[model samples]
Target: MKKKHVLRLLAAAVTMGMLAGTASCGNANQKTAQENPLAEEADSAQTEQEHESAEEVDMVFRGGTVITMLSEDDTDNTAVAVKDGEIVYVGDEEGIETYISDATEVIELDGQTLMPGFIDGHIHEPGNMMTEKKELILPEGQADLDVYKKELQSFIDANPDLPIYKASGMDLQAFPDNIADNEWMDELDTDKPVVIADVSSHGNLANKIALEMAGVTKESTPPDGGKIFFDEEGELTGYLSDAVSLLSTLPIIEYTEEDFSSAMKEFQELANSYGLTAIDSGGTIYETEDPNQYEVLSNMHSAGDLTLRINTTSWAGQPLEGKESDRLIKLLDDSQKYTSDFLQICQVKFSLDGVPEGATSALLEPYTKEAGQEEGYAGTQKATEEDLTAFVTAMNAAGYSVETHAMGDASVQRSMNAFEAASEANGGTPDGVINKIAHVNLLTTEDMTRMADEGVIAAMQPLWFYYDPFFSAQEESNLGKERFEQEYHIRDMIDEGIIITGSNDYPVTADFAPLHAIEAGATQQSPYEGEDDDPAYIRNPEQSATVYEMLQMYTVNAAYGAHMDDIVGTVEEGKKADFVILGDNPLTCDVKAISDITVEYTISDGRIVYQK
Candidate 1:
């Protein structure tokens, strides 16, 4: 419930660095050649002969239960052969042995299981990169208003000279009115500018000084696609959503290029520890006039600082900025400058709607009036239908996919309609791009079928598929009981033949472990074993997916979603040598035990990057 829980999970991930280091592996390989010089000449001659006779490979992994994830024919005891960062062979030991030479590094897998490295389909690079920095003050867990005040005060006392004090991770539900009251914030610190962000990161609470510092007044107009709140007396309530929240918070915190690069490294390392070979940075936006995340990632990839693959989609900016066709087209054209094996720009992303928790999602039907919202409120849409359709059509015609943030049924329907029309207008489905919709928490049966038929990818956060009283209790008020009870139908999508991929949407969720997501998808239950397990909290038991099905969503399906399937999805010939060695086979192990399995080794680009 708090950011501390996420940090704790990351703390555990840091320990995974103890897995054998890549440096040690290289050193061992080098030592083998230096130990003996007298026989080196003869060994070299013999090795050359063997290399000529055998199709020389750099590494060979054998003696394990290998789940190729390609098909049944390629499963079980499959030895993998890698040469120059690409898999040369994946078959029975007898067949793969033909490619192994004297210089090949042989890795004995023992009884462990080997599978494709996890691909997190959706996440944010900025938050994941900046969590450890002191600029952001994070509370331990579900803290009340008093706890937040104490923490904020402590932060102010530590950095008293800071011109602006910005802190995120406050649970809005803990406030008296379920929102950070500007009056309460002012009481805490009247002198310093204070802007506390909601846990969702889509909104923030600004004190009077902070609001004044941002030049916001009762007569001030908020940027497009954002909202500024006020009380009955027309006084600023200090709450800002979307564009306004970003505008107020980002400028106050001083972040340098070095900080961003360092954060990227940390994010990559943690992901490697979890056996992730690639991650799709769902979307990244900057407060600066020109976003530099593309440059930062490119520099890292060029300098050999990037150890995992990064696929990014440029943010479409605030919706009110008008149609940015020219700017977007230029950005896409510029994407050609950094296309590499480690990094690439893939799509454009736009927030079609807000979240349901705040009653801002574009729902087809009105929400229950019990939540204190207006009688006919169906939430707000960031852009008009005409603009959305035009944007999608333009992007698709340009050979680029667009990932839309659609959480409600109405938003989903509109997005799907745009995609369908664009595809039809283009004379066929868009090529070289996988159109995606993030967080389809609610959807209609017909739309779900349409999504499947159109091949639109579902970038889902299965970790959010928890059925708990604390969350379910707010369903009727945010959404009617009927819709609330039918949320996140995982099994239903699988049955509909939709291409689904599992993601963490990190910084929002504490954990991004694929095993946890797989288990949650199969059970439609919470992963926190220590938390509430009441049967009454189950969201939809009948929507449970099969373990194998969920595994596909995490691995091969995820790779397909990212358009990296040709290079690194399954353990097969001519693919990148990326494999995760696990303590137990997730497919054969007890379903509940999947999340308990520890990663033993993570091999990327023909090298053992992580070993347990």
Candidate 2:
């Protein structure tokens, strides 16, 4: 994702001349005035008659199938009336017309189905934003490996002196030969590093420079359950993940405010393109240092340009004593209170285990494939129970919600116990604090009931089944037959009422698309119709959810996951007017057709953020 920074520079350089030319003339003011006449008029509407109806309404949406996800309790075709950014009326369209004044701007949905803006509960939104800020290395659906490599090389050839050249949309899986083998980089100038990130974002290939700059050695052991690839000769491989020792021994590249602001605009567009009216992102700026750097979502909120309602969170830095931990808690508590109808601060996130492929995830038993034979102990544990108790306890006491990463079942158990311990220490049930287990690829039955009874949210990535062989074929190879069934039990969790939300761990497994996430969760099928279906990996195909259930998970269920259930989850009156106009009703569409359906428009807080 560092590629975004470099791309932004090139973008600015190319536009520098154009900007200078425009600034030299005075026509810009006239154009701005002509474009914003209505806004000017609205601002000046203090005339006699205008004053009488000044507070009447700002806008109205008419003539569409309003699938108001007002509440999980309310169903489809729910119309809404907007006043400012909030929904003033929601229900049958009967009396809604009365709210539409002559001054109101109304849009006819043209039979399009409307629902609460799709909320993707999990996303590396900055990474997604980074992708958008970049030049198109691969056109839409042009993800073939050879073609992608050729394009990337072309980019490198075009920019000779740029020390680092990186591409984002290509897939690591697309190449038959693993990237670490160095076959791909030999053709390029290894003097300057080139890392082509996999679409999943979980792993990336580093040319010689990035590896040396990070000081990775073939003998480099991972800090946790991370994997650092090594050549057969015990030399370092270019691949890095879980083993990066991430926050610790890394050099801090100070990013400028300009970089952040530019990235924010791109990320906002990325969210809207996928019909995301709301999203919960996994990045530090969102949770810990929101004030330090204006996160794209934060900037959007401040400008009231937030087209998608966002509830983003990150975590505390290393351990701190009474003073450090306490200060962190206070910070989150103070920020979580940032109650905008558009952006809401929700939880603090922490990674308990590492990546699945890296085998950093904490599992009770050693992985079957790597087993005790491979170089290390079954992934290293980050925080001990005492440490976890202290951290979680402080967060719980501060009334801050948690979104911890625990891919392995053992790690999941540990995080859950910490939350439980924190609850017990805090005088009562902290169950409603909205702590969640993200990326629960391996959950047990007992965990299910405990989550439901304890009210812990399960923020899961449904896109996994579409990429790689997600079935236990690999884990089973290492563990056994029984281990596989524990992979994805989507229906079982819903049945247990383990409040859930679907997400695309963008730059990791899938792009952040709610429709694709839902289609994967509901049909257990890939969105690409041309590709072969995964018979081996689609675990428990019978466990797929109903259209309404999947839809709610994308809409109300996601809001509920973010603890904004009463606000923008629905298309009802008195709620935020955040919604999307779908090309086809997801609920009414054929099972497989859901993923293929496009969004015609996306309205966030009654603002037309995206229109097809």
Q: Candidate 2: deviation at residue 112, Å?
A: 2.9
> So what's the TM-score on candidate 2?
0.79
Error of 2 at 408 (Å): 1.0
Write candidate 2's Cα lDDT for 1-612 as tens digits: 111100000000011111111110101121211134553464433433443443557776666677764333445444566787787654445545666777888777676777888888776656644443333345434435567667877776776655456665554334443233455666664466566544434445666666777666665655544566666666666766554453233332244556566666677787898788877766632222565543445555677755666666656544423454676666655654455655556467777776554445677766754332264346656667677778878776666677777777787788878878888888854433567778776766878788776667777776664323422233444444566555667777777767667776665543567787677677655555553264543556766777677777677667766656656665654567777888887777787788778888887777888887
The window of 10 residues in a row where model 2 has the poorest summed lDDT is: 4-13
**TM-scores for all predictions:** 0.87, 0.79
Off by over 4 Å in 2: 1-58, 70-78, 131-179, 182-187, 192-200, 204-214, 218-221, 246-254, 284-290, 295-299, 317-327, 330-339, 370-377, 429-432, 466-482, 531-538
Angstrom error of the Cα, residue 288, model 2: value is 11
How well is each residue in 258-329 modelled by candidate 1, as lDDT tens digits?
777887777777877888888777775233333477787788877877777777778786552435766886
